[model samples]
Target: MASTHPEHLSGSTADYSVAVPKSMFPGLFVLGMVSWTLVEYLIHRFLFHMKPPSDSHYLIMLHFVMHGQHHKAPFDGSRLVFPPVPASLVIAFFYVFLRLILPEAVAGIVFAGGLLGYVFYDMTHYYLHFGSPHKGSYLYNMKAHHVKHHFEYQKSGFGISTKLWDYFFHTLIPEESHPKMQ
Candidate 1:
């Protein structure tokens, strides 16, 4: 399903499209969002945090910009919502990379879906720290998990919208540290 929240459809601020589509089929868009979330979670927990070999200062710097800074300043609102220019360039790069390996139509659809997912994650992460979720909902739980990543343990709980990826990868923190949904 497409996100019911308006924030997921925009970027940077409420006044702009940023890197998103003006309108999209909700089902396809939601699917894209979820699939991309997994990809995003994986990339953040692994590739972006990779310990590059010696003589790879450029890669380490790139990682710092792409993700490390977020860990360093998790509550910074401006940093929370992805800046559109850099996000668009990254998305385009992914499109081209996938295009070389998949059929055109499939690649286009998946890329579109993944882009929508990234949009949702950026917006949701912003809200989790700034706007707040309902008192007792999955979003509420997710917000707590994210805050833990920032305040207590930076190494796990990488999932944003859901923890399925963390669970699957055995990167979930201890239950005592995570707490039950409020």
Candidate 2:
């Protein structure tokens, strides 16, 4: 059945977000955002860092194009984000999956939150590559963590937007003895 709320399909933020009770909306939004972090960590660790069999050149090249290229050229501004076409497909998959499990209005707000989380992840990934984050700040710590992952601990510290999962999964990079990255 078509949702009577045409605004649900429209890009109007207020319409879908307020579909739920005021108290429930905040928690659901945060849940969706945090869920994206889990997705990001899992995708990076399991897919992006997957080891292809040595005999299969096709898998090796595919891995390189999917993620190895980023490790090879971290500052390639052009490679900072998933290409729009591929990204849209992934986003659609998530939206459809979320809609299947949650009520229409609730799913809309949750998807909105997850979408925002994705944006933050991309921006943070780009900044960590190029920005000179202030020392002793969160971004600086994240930059140092990410730099360590790139240059040294490639097998660990998979969390890019936040290290909360790395800590939980026991894959957090060990504390650096040297001065943190500038």
Candidate 3:
């Protein structure tokens, strides 16, 4: 039977009539991807890691449901990706929001780019937990940085697809300390 998941249906053909100019689409798409990296950084840092009150069981449970579980089980493959149901809702919201602020064609192209970026981020996060990348590679460095975020620097190192935001926000993990001259 055909899968009923939103992810399965997400590959439905787009309306090329609403597409941005061929030349501009690539630039706009890249801009959207870059914008997604910033959004990822902000949400991960500010929202996911926000500390709920000590006495509120409901808030604590909500925190666990949202993000604490990931920290609690960094290697859980099932929880790695945003579930398609909730993801679809967020995607729809962005689609409507973008359409409101931008031309339909431009918004579609940019939204497609942001969606692709989110896919990349989810896959990269899963791979960081499970796949072993070659040392000195980009994925290798990212995996190392992400591991530090999980285990050592929970308050920083929120960047996943890129470190640009962490650098911009001064939240990048610090290097190992070295002794200075006495």
Using lDDT as the measure, the top candidate is 2
- Which residue pairs show collisions in model 3? none
> All candidates' TM-scores?
0.70, 0.85, 0.84
**How would the candidate models be sorted by TM-score, starting from the highest?**
2, 3, 1
lDDT of 2 by residue, 124-152 (tens): 99999999999999999999999999989
TM-score of decoy 2: 0.85
Residue range 104-168, candidate 3, lDDT tens digits: 77888899999899999989988999999999999999999999999999999999989999999
What is the C-alpha local distance difference test score of each model?
A: 0.75, 0.92, 0.89
After the best TM-score superposition of candidate 2, give how far the Cα of residue 161 lies from its true spot, in angstroms: 0.7
RMSD of each: 13.0, 6.3, 9.2
lDDT-better candidate, 2 vs 3: 2
Compared with the true structure, what per-residue lDDT tens digits does model 1 show for residues 105-176? 556666788887787787788888887678788888888888887888778888876788999999886667
Quality of model 1 by C-alpha lDDT? 0.75
Deviation from native of the Cα of residue 45 in model 1, angstroms: 0.6
Stretches of candidate 2 off by over 4 Å are 1-19, 178-182
